[model samples]
Target chain A: MENVIKIRGLTKNYGKNRGVIDVNLDVAKGDVFGFLGPNGAGKSTTIRSMLGFLRFDEGSISILGMDSVRDHEKILRDVGYMPSEAWFYDTMRVSEVIKYAADVRGLDCAQEAAKLCERLKVDTHKKIKELSLGNRKKVSIVCAMQHRPKLFIFDEPTSGLDPLMQRNFFNLIDEYVRDGATCVLSTHVLSEVNRYCRHAAIMRDGRLMMLEDTNIDEDAFLKYYMDEEEM
Target chain B: MRAVFVREIRLNMKQLIIWSLTVGILGLVCILMYDSMQGDMKSMADMFSQMGAFSDAFGMSTLSIATVEGFFATEVGTVHGLGGAMFAAILAIGIISKEEDGHTGEFLLSLPISRRRVVAAKGGCVLVCLAAFSCVCALFYALGFVMLGEDIPFSKLAVFMAMQLLMNIEISAICFFISGVSPKINIGAGLGVALICYVYDLVGRVVPDMKDYLFMGPYSYANASEIFSGADIAVAGVAVGLVITVVAYVSTFVCFDRRDLAS
Candidate 1:
């Protein structure tokens, strides 16, 4: 399968500190790529650079074979991104934010938005500030998934979601992949890696620890990592 | 850019509404206070002293509040100047900084827009908001005259409001510039801008000899109080204010585009 996202020697530096250093990875089309890392492991940094939010001192990023920065606008048209932090105008109700997002993308995803909101049990009429953490996550998910972008990027997508909603999210991704969309999920949730991802890249301290298919269960992988640390 | 602009507008409207209401209430209270003072006050000198104590920041030299021109200075300068400056500072502080503060920039940046476009669009929204507020204030001022049973010339009102409009853009630009440069601080940019303006006002008041060099002071407006008399407009000051706005806005964009966002 062709890669949805391709990176070669991607390096980003914030002054003397390392943001991401010599990182390389590829997420295949129609594949659920779980990009796992510890806190401050450069997963978000790498993802942001791929999305062109941060400038990299060295390397190349190709989104479906188009240069990430050069074709950023065109790529964004069909790329659904959910940032780790959920932000919306507090005065705006959930529906209004969704409408605003949809309007920006020129997508008539209202019915889809309604379905997602209902599925996640998010109150569409309530202010974003008034919503609970899980509900706010639902808001982000609904907006991200509603547009049906071909390439999906979710940064800590399940951070505020309850277990039930998280399961719903997995099912939603399954359906999306079945329809031939690509997804790159940046998260440390091990279960999510086992449950949804066909490909996984583990990162630690601004570098890739491993890139492997999930041939073994998550417990075995955890044991191996722990055993390696002890050694 | 338009898509981003539209969203910026949606966000700015809520802010504009809040600022408009607060500023409007303050103006109304001042008008009410002015109405109540007629019976108790002995002379315009007493009134100017009282008002000076209340709003020394707005006046260059105390004037008789009883006279319409002095009333305009007190009402427009001190009342609107301080309030308007504060209003502008707060508005500018958020325009460039709020998205990053709320972590919304991460989400928005991931979209197809460039950093430059984001900066320009966001800055443009601030200008739109300021313009909208100016229109509302002008409307209320006209309403104030009607309530007082005064028949002021529309042309004079236009000239006065025009100078205010120019001054406001300058204030907003400086505050917004502060926003882009200092994101970790909450409304620190606005407070800083207000302080700088207040200092300029002080220097203008304390040193009349240096008035040639310190045109930035709101006191400059005071020195040219006759400009609003429907006689002659000070086109030069307005031109200087425009230049400051442009430079401040451009600096803000440069700072925003180069900074690391995910951090």
Candidate 2:
């Protein structure tokens, strides 16, 4: 299978601190790839570099066979991205926020957005500021999924979601994957990787410690977390 | 681009209305009060025109405050000029930086649009809002003239307003550049720019040596008293303002495109 994302020698830094050092990664098309890391482990930094949001010190990132920096606009057309925290225009209604997202992509996503909202149980009439964290996450999910892009990049997607909503979100992801879409799910949750990911990469201290198939036992995954805690 | 433009306009609508109305109403009230203060102003104009440096700074030596035209020029002119500059500065200064400050830049920049396009769309929003503000305030001034049954000084008013628009655009362009380079919204710095420019113009008028270099500031060409007194427009000042506006506007696009946006 062809790779949808490719990174080589990726390095980013903030002064003396490490961001990501000499990192290399690839996510093949149609694969559910889990990027697991603890807070401050540089998962978000690597993801942002891939999305052309940050200027890395040294690296090359290609997404959907296009340069992340040079062809950013083209790559975004077929990529759906959801940040860890969903911050929107607070005064706008949920429906309006969704519409704005769709409008920027120049897509008619009303039907898809409505279906997503129904499944997620989002109140379209309420202002964004009026929604709970879970509800706001639901809105972010709807906005990301409505356009039905070929790839989805979700960072800590289930943090604010309740158990039920988390199940719904995974179900939605499963549906997209079944339709031949690729996904890069960045999260610290091991169970989510065990349940959904086919391939997973463990990151620690701005380094990729291991990349393996999810067939590994839960105890093996827990060892990586435990080792970090001990250190 | 249109999507971002429309969204910015919608987001900024409330601010536009509030700033425009506050300045507009203040100008209208001052225009209305001219009738009640006519007698007192007639005597005051003579005293004011003879106050040397103070008179020169406020343009009382060139335009008497006894007549409605002079009153509008000195009073309503100062109000609109200062208010418009501050509004333009405040609006443009926060526009780009506020995205990061509010944590909305992640959502916005993630869209399938380039940073250059985003900057262009926001620049369009600032221009449109400033134009609308000028029009609304101009209408209020016109209404006041109608109620008082005075001749509307159409030509002079047009020149004054056009110059004021250019001045505001110059101020806003500088602030827009500042917003692009800054990580957070700096309202204090924005207001400070406007205040400093106004003071520069006031001091330059009274201090003879500074008069020649007054074109360096935006307020020189937009001076109300000079326009109403039938003095020629300061072409050099206007040209310098336009040049600064273009340079700053272009710099914003260049700087923002290279920025590493905060998540």
Candidate 3:
């Protein structure tokens, strides 16, 4: 398998407080890679650094064979991102936001977005501020997924989604990985990992505790977490 | 960057419209009032003396208001002072912080552009809107001259415009820097700050002692009736503008790079 992301000795600080500390990881192409962590476990910090939204004091990050900082914009074009909290302009309708997103990525997602929204049970015509949290999540998901990107980086993407929708999302993600797309998903939903991810990394308190390749049910995964945290 | 610039301009339509209409109508009304009061003063000093107490309160006697040039002085210092300050502050604060406040900044960062490019594109949008808005005010100025027949010097009109542009650009640059650092809701507070400075400008013009302190106001350069009296470009004004724009751009770049993506 080809390497899609390679990080070495990455460290980041926020005004003397630690953000990410000497982190290193790799995800192969065609991966459904789960980044497992509770809140404030450096999941977001590591992701931001990967996107070139944060500065690191020491390390090298390469994505798709390009230097992360030097080729940030070009690399971003090849990836789709679903932020932990996707926000919208209050004045813009769901359709407008999705359309603008597609345009920004140099794609025309209008027709695709309409179909996607319908599948996700989202209304495209309403203002963003009027939508429920779950609907807004669907909007962000549709926008992020419409580009058919080489890599999909998501941070807690399933938070506002209902259980059924999450299961549907897992099916869609499985299809992408089967088709050779790469994924880096961070979420507290261990079941999502059990459903789709081939590999996973567990992080805690700004440290990577382990990276695992396992087949386990949610019941077993929690038991595993308990044993590992005790270590 | 170009696409970003285009998008910013498209979204800025309502702001441009409101500022243009609001400033244009007020300018026309002022011109009509100027027509009614034209040559009513016996002398330049007499004009100063008649409003001596009121002028003393606001600082209007540094140069003469009796001549057409003096009329330009009054217009640039007063109209542009109040209106331009609010316009610059409101637009600048809205451009950057509005995205963050609404949680759109994170989504915007996901696009294929550097944060520097994003800031630059929005800054360019500011200049573009400023240019178009200036032209609208100029059109109203021409109409004012054509309809009112006040015989204000054509040269003085250009000087009035140049001075207004300088003030607007300077204040807008300051507001942009603040937008990068402050929370989105703080924009209204920034506009309030601009208004307070407007009062300072009104004071600086009538009081020469206040001239030294006029640096406190964004439009204080309009107080240059002493130097701009003969159409001097005021290199000091240019230098000040360069300083403000440069500092704002640098601070904005640094802030955007380090701040967490809110959306």
Q: Write the per-residue lDDT of candidate 3 for residues A165-217, one digit (tens) a residue.
A: 88777777777678778999998887777767788987776777555554656
Model 2's CAPRI class is: high
- Candidates sorted on lDDT, descending: 2, 3, 1
Kindly list the per-residue Cα lDDT of model 3 for residues B14-112, writing each as its tens digit: 889899878877876766666556677446446564586456543345556555445545654467567767887788887888877777777888888
* Collision pairs in model 3: B59-B205, B59-B206, B59-B207, B60-B206
- Candidate 3: deviation at residue B188, Å? 5.3
Candidate 1: tens digits of C-alpha lDDT, residues B203-234: 65556565565565543543323544343455
Flag clash pairs in model 2. none
lDDT (0 to 1) per candidate: 0.74, 0.92, 0.75
Cα RMSDs, all models: 3.7, 1.4, 3.5
Candidates 1 and 2 compared: the better one by lDDT is: 2
Q: Candidate 1: which stretches are off by over 4 Å? A: A217-220, A223-230, B1-15, B21-66, B218-224, B229-232
Ranking by TM-score: 2, 3, 1
Model 3: lDDT of residue A215: 61
Which ranges in model 2 have alpha carbons more than 4 Å from their true place? A215-231
Off by over 4 Å in 3: A211-213, A216-231, B37-47, B50-76, B183-185, B192-220, B224-231, B258-263
lDDT of 2 by residue, B1-263 (tens): 99999999999999999999999999999999999998799789999999998899999999999989899999998999999999999999999999999999989988899999999999999999999999999999999999899989899988988999999999999999999999899999999999999999999999999989999999999999999999999999999999999999999999999988987
